[model samples]
Target: MKAIYLESINAPFVLIEKEKPTAGPGEAVVQVKAAALNHRDVYIQYGRYFTKEYPAILGSDGAGIVTEVGAGVAPDWVSKEVVLDPSTDWGDNPGVHSKEYKVLGMPQEGTFAEYVKVPATNLHEKPAHLSFEQAAALPLAGVTAWRTLFTKCALQPGEKVLITGIGGGVALAALQFAVALGAQVWVTSSSEEKIEKAKALGATGGINYKTENWGKALKADVGGIDVSIDGAAGEGFVQLVKVANPAGRIGMYGGTTGMIGQINPAEIFWKQLNIYGSTMGTNQDFAAMMAFVREKKVTPVVDSTFRLEETEHAMRYMEAGKQFGKIVLRVG
Candidate 1:
């Protein structure tokens, strides 16, 4: 099997031939057809995120065909096309994950290889409407967005919703899901072009956050938003607060821009707004996300596809913050 191995933090990804892994008990070996890049992968590469080991494979989102089933696994799983739920050991709590919870990749070998092994329970039939590349794009980002909007915030149809930093995968997935659910969605992006692109994907409108008074502009132009999904939590976070309606719901997943500064406590309590922190979701969340994707015929926005060996180029592209959607790697 050919795999991209990271020898250490900040080390270059090396494509090397390695022994194919066999399915362990309750696991299956998947012949990876495609893998997708996430911001978490970049963070791991830079040694900024969770990683307890070196010489590791680094990918969390994948779609492929099951080639082998381990002992105790159903033989019927073999030969079935599947997408992996990267979230593992989510435990019993619906509202929170246990200490045992972890996402794939990092300490465990991941999908950036010709073959990768995962628990049989983590596999779901790929949505028929999506190709391998698109299915690969959905798992991490789609589940996160689904849990953030539907589970955490409980967004309703016809509500005015805003998604911050619209070009990234999770944010774009939220935009798509909210729009499909009949919410009037708005977005923010530093790039006017990306904003227009988001609008083409069903966003009601968007704003360039680089402009002065953009938050006020949103409040004045679009009116107060009933829900806001945010990833970047630096300087612009106050803007999201400014644009929220009374009793608005805000769900945050990542703080990509760094720590937030200078927020008014009065705005939160006086407005009776609710804010929730979210991350990669549970197995049930993954299932619901897939069902929604299938029901809505949602297609993940794939910005580019690179061959398996082109791992560095894909990482660089994602690091440059230039992608309008998920970046996929063709594995098989």
Candidate 2:
């Protein structure tokens, strides 16, 4: 098999000949047709993520075909077109994942190769409306957005939404889902061009967060936000609160900007705000999200696509934070 083997932390992605893996019990081998990059892959490369182990594969989102099924797996799975659910071991609880929960592409081998093995349960039929590249972009970002919005915040059709950092995969997925659900959506981005792109995708309005007091400006301009979504949490997090309407809900999936600074207690308590910390979704969430995608015809935005061998360049592009959607690596 040809694979991008990360020999060590911070090593460049160099495709090399490697042994292809066979499926284990209850597992299946996917011949990767397309895969997508996430910020997690970048952090893992620099030894900045939870696991420092190297000599591993790094990828989270992929769409492909089942080539083989392991012992106890149904033979019928072979030749099925599928997208992988990157989240695993979510356990019985919906409110939180078990201690054993993990997103694919770290300690476990991932989808950055010609063939990758995953639990058969993680295989989902690709949404009929999506291409391999589009399906590859959907799994991780789509489920994260779905759980954060409808599951955590219970966003309603007529409610207003504010999605911070508009251009990234997860943020764009949330924007598309919210728009499809008939919500009035707003967004924030460092790039005016990205803001414009979000508008083209159905966002009602947006603001350049680089401006001083941009959140306050957004609140003033848009009246009040009924729901807010964020990934970067830093001193500026208070701004999300500033723009939120009373009883507004804010769902945060990541803290890329490090620890959040102080927020006014009154704003949270008096307004009865709900702040939820979220991560990857459960099995149930993944199924529900895929159904939503099928019903809504939501397409995962692709900023660009590169050949699988251009892994390093694609990683650099995502790290630059300049893309307006998911970056795909065409495999197979």
Candidate 3:
């Protein structure tokens, strides 16, 4: 089996041959078809996120066909196409995994390979409407966006939302989901070119944060927003505070702008705004998101695709902050 192995922090991933893993009890071995990249991968690679053991496999979202089902798994699961959930839990016991917790690809081996073995519960039916590449793109970013909007912020129809950083996978997903829910979407990006891309994705308006003060622009042009979807938690959080309407919510996820930001207490008190922090969602959230994808035909915005062995190039593109959406690796 060919896998991309991270030998050291902040170093390039290497393609290497390793023995294919066998399914353990309650686990299944999948022949991976496609894997998607996220900003979390970059942070993990640079030691800014998950702490890694040597030679870690680095992909968290992927789709594939089930090849083997271990003991205690149902027979019908074998030979079925599936998407990896990435989130996991250990029964009602609290040990290696919590009573309700653990994330695949964080402390365990991940899907940057020809095969991956995970608990049968972590597998989900791939939306019939998606190709392997499309399904691969959905698991992490899609779930995160759904959790942020529908779960955390509870965005309402016809409301205004100011989304930060238009090109990233999560932001792009949030934009489409917001529009589908009938919200008027306002987006921001550092590049004008990227802003145009957001417009193509149904954003009602986009601000080139490079040339414009997004906070002031939102206040003047869009009349302030009802919700602010902020994945980049930098100086921009202050902007979020400025642009939100009274009783508005700021959904914060990533720290693409270096993890720290300022919050004005007076404004927070005056506006009575809510700051919501969301991470990847529950298995139930993933199921509902898939239903939305299937019924609404909402496709993920893929920026580019690469061959499995070309993962290093994909990582480089993500690190350069050049992609307008998810980057995928065509595995198997």
Candidate 4:
């Protein structure tokens, strides 16, 4: 088997041949077909959230076939096509990262390999409509968007949502999901090209984060948003807070713009606004999201595909924000 191994922080991934791993009890060995990049991978490479573990396989989202299942695993799992559910819990406990759970690709070996093993519980049936690459793109981003809107905010039809940072996979999924649910969606991106892409994807309108006052522009276009999905948590979160309707919700997920922010407690109090923080969703949420995708014909936005050996270049593309959507690595 060939796999990607990261030796240290900010280092290039090394492609090496290794022995294939077998499944353990209650686990399944996935013959990885495709793996996708996440901003979290960049952070792990930079030693942000994950520790520097040499020879680590760094990827969380993947789609593949179950080649082997260990003892105690259901016999029906054999040869089943599946995608991983990256989140361990739906927030029955507070905090996305704690001692309770760790996302794949960080603390544990990930799917950037010919084969990877995980608990059978993490596997979800892959929709026949999706190719291996597209299936790989959905697990992390799709699950996060699902938890943010459906679980955390309980976003409803006819409401308005402001989704920031248009090009990432999650933002695209959020926009598509909101639109599918009959919500009016507005998007923001620094790139005009990305803004146009968002509009073409059913966004009512969008603002170029490079030039326009997105917050004020959103207010003008939609009056105010019932919910603001802020993937970029820097100055943009403050603006997301600014554009929310009274008693509206702000779903804070990632920190593409950096984590720390200046937030006004008074506005939150006076407006009776609610802030919900979410990450990748629970197993149940993953199932619901997949069902929705299958039913609604929702397609994940895929920017590019690379062979497993090209993992290094894919990481560079994601870090540079050169890709419009998820950059995937076809493993086998």
Best by TM-score: 1
**Using Cα atoms with residue i matched to residue i, what is each candidate's TM-score against the true structure?**
0.98, 0.98, 0.93, 0.94
lDDT score, candidate 2, position 224? 94
lDDT of 4: 0.86
Instruction: Note the residue pairs that clash in candidate 3.
Output: none
For candidate 4, what is the TM-score? 0.94
Backbone clashes in each candidate structure, one number apiece? 0, 0, 0, 0
Worst lDDT run of 10 residues, candidate 3, spans 90-99
lDDT string for model 3 (223-300, tens) is 889988888887778888988899999998778677555776988989999988888877777788888888888888
lDDT digits (tens) for residues 1-332 of candidate 2: 88887889889988888888899899999999999999989988898888777788889999999999999999999999999999888888889999888888887888889899999999999988899999999999999999999999999999999999899988999999999999999999988899999999999999988889888899889899999999998966999999999999999998878889888899999999999998889999999999999999898999999988999999998998889899999997
User: What is the full ranking by lDDT, best candidate first?
Assistant: 1, 2, 4, 3
Question: Model 3, clash count?
Answer: 0
Expressed as tens digits, the lDDT of each residue in 23-101 for candidate 1 is: 9899999999999999888788888885567768989999999999999999999999999999888899999999989
Worst 10 residues of 1 by lDDT: 46-55
Instruction: Give the candidate order by descending TM-score.
Output: 1, 2, 4, 3
Pairs with backbone N, CA or C atoms under 3 Å apart (clashes), candidate 2: none
Best by lDDT: 1
Whole-model lDDT values for every prediction = 0.93, 0.92, 0.85, 0.86
